[model samples]
Target: MSTNSWDPWNYRSGSDFGTGHDLAGLSVQATDGHIGKVDEATYETGGSYLVVDTGPWIFGKKVLLPAAVVRSVDVEKKDIYVDLTKDQIKSSPKFEEGGTWSDTTHRDEVGTYYGQYDKGL
Candidate 1:
């Protein structure tokens, strides 16, 4: 499903940006949310992302996501959904949080990880 059809598109809106918010319950699965995390941040251009906190293994890391990887959102419970799997998410190369994604090299990995899944959405 497109972000527009999601129940709570507030995050999809621009009213709130660069502010801390809660997305803990959103069903974030890759490959249609079978394995992603919560809907973390929606970019300024209407693109949403999943913050894959690397947990204790790789420390707390995060990543960016576009609608291409997103499948839907649960508005009734204020949740976000996706169409991915855990192995796929876990297998992807990890990154450090916050200050990481700024390099061209770092940005390139996004596509590398996403691979054909990007589909240029």
Candidate 2:
């Protein structure tokens, strides 16, 4: 993982994905398989993230994925790929609907969970 795991929370550099495009409704693929669709996306410099609506995969659960995990974006196919497994996303801190990103506590919790790969978790 990158030393600053949360840095550059946009689509990976040189992936040719447009930052201004609407990602909501696009399918999101995990390293293993399809996980959900992008319910929301942000391109904020260091706080970018994706709110994925898991539909029936996790009983309509939604997961917040840090943009750092985004490996690529396929606008043609309308798919977003992330460098993470379903289990990894499943194990992340539970995200409540209608939560705001301004909540630093929750964001910190999320950052901590995703950053654990560096510690060999």
**Against the correct fold, how does model 1 do in TM-score?**
0.53
> Please, what are the lDDT tens digits per residue for candidate 1 over residues 15-94?
22233555554545445333435435544343344555434433444555543454455555555555456556666655
> In model 2, which residue pairs have backbone atoms overlapping below 3 Å?
none
Q: Which of the numbered candidates is closest to the native, going by highest TM-score?
A: 2
TM-score of each: 0.53, 0.84
- The parts of candidate 2 lying over 4 Å away from their true place are 1-10, 118-121
Which residue runs of candidate 1 sit more than 4 Å off their true CA positions?
1-25, 31-39, 46-48, 54-63, 118-121
Q: 1-121 in candidate 2: lDDT tens per residue? A: 6554445345557555677788899999987999999998887777788889999999988888877677788888999987788999888898665778546778778877877653221
Candidate 1, run of 10 with poorest lDDT: 7-16
lDDT of all predictions:
0.46, 0.78
Q: What is the lDDT of candidate 1?
A: 0.46
